[model samples]
Target: MINSNSRSVAALVALLVATAMPAFAQPPASPAVPAAAVTSDAGVSGTAGSSRDAARARRKANRQLVKRVAAVLARTRGLDSSRILIRAADGTVTLSGTVPDNMQIPLAVNAAQQVAGVTVLRNQLRIGMRME
Candidate 1:
């Protein structure tokens, strides 16, 4: 002889309790991962050493090319070798510093281009005022 509203409330509470009971219960334990299945660090040193050696060889070749470009520029006519700064990387030569006249700029570039290993030439020379 309960009121219908009260009956509905009681049924709702029972349903909620039944649904939440499993959520509060402890779950079954899972097996641990096997050690053999875990990933390992391999070939770490060999890969690093090979890259280092390749970089070293590249730098050595760049240094030799720089020397060759500088020597050629020093021997070019109408250019002051002492006033020019030369730097090379990966077969590219960079010429910087001030020269006595604007004509020396092209002269320097031409000399660097004549070198066997030069792939690019960068001219950064400035023409200084004539000395009396």
Candidate 2:
């Protein structure tokens, strides 16, 4: 009976140690990622930078087109270029605001279309014909 009680106590102690070992153990370290692997072939950062650059270039080109179209309209005879408003986006030009006469609407649209880099032209000009 004495020998059996000693064995039972030893087994209980072993069981307690087994359960406590994990609480004292250190966590496993995470694997490190290589720099080359992280940046391999058009990674997220690289692609985003390139896309931003492309967007900037497109915006610059559109601004240039707006200037060119505005210059053409300014040079056109019998058209009040000051009253005409020009906006360009993605090579598309929008001509808006009041023109002195109805004939100037087509003139302005044609002038904008003749300019290079104009993919689309939207004419929103209204004639403010004077009664006087």
Candidate 3:
């Protein structure tokens, strides 16, 4: 007893209602993440990132201080790069090697000490001694 146009309209309405029902009935939910998993992920990045950054900065600063101290020693009176050896451990400077004369020992020590990051200077310069 239904008209052809009426039947088509009813079919379209049914299709529309079927599609709209699911969307209106529920909103999309975020995937459920466990608290432990979230915390572990964050903790890994937290400590590692900060410590890595600090270590990089420290290494860079140490290299710069080494360069500056080496430059000073190279230009110092009676002191040459060959006669000077410098090792820096966490800002403590250790100077080794031989100079032309005994008095050059103090000059080498003073040169290393004046560097900005040099906290300790261990001078092991033995004048008139040669290393082969």
Name the runs in model 1 displaced over 4 angstroms: 1-42, 129-132
Model 2, residue 100: C-alpha shift (Å): 1.1
Candidate 2: pairs in clash: none
For residues 8-120, what per-residue lDDT tens digits would candidate 3 score against the true structure? 88987785576445445542222333454334476577766676687678767777877888999988877655756666667867676557677788888888898888988
Error of 1 at 118 (Å): 0.7
After best superposition, candidate 3 residue 98: deviation in angstroms?
Answer: 2.4
Q: What does candidate 2 score in Cα RMSD to the true structure?
A: 31.0
- In candidate 3, the residue pairs with backbone N, CA or C atoms under 3 Å apart (3 or more residues apart, or in different chains) clash, namely none
**lDDT (Cα, 0-100) at 100 in candidate 1:** 80
lDDT of 2 by residue, 1-132 (tens): 999999988987785575446435623322344464444354577865676687679778878888899999999887887777787887778787777788888888888899988889988677663323
lDDT of 1 by residue, 28-73 (tens): 3223445553444475566556756876797788889878888888
- Per-residue error (Å), model 3, residue 49: 2.1
Q: For each candidate, what TM-score against the reference? A: 0.63, 0.63, 0.59
Q: Which of 1 and 2 is ahead in lDDT?
A: 2
For model 1, name the residue pairs that clash: none
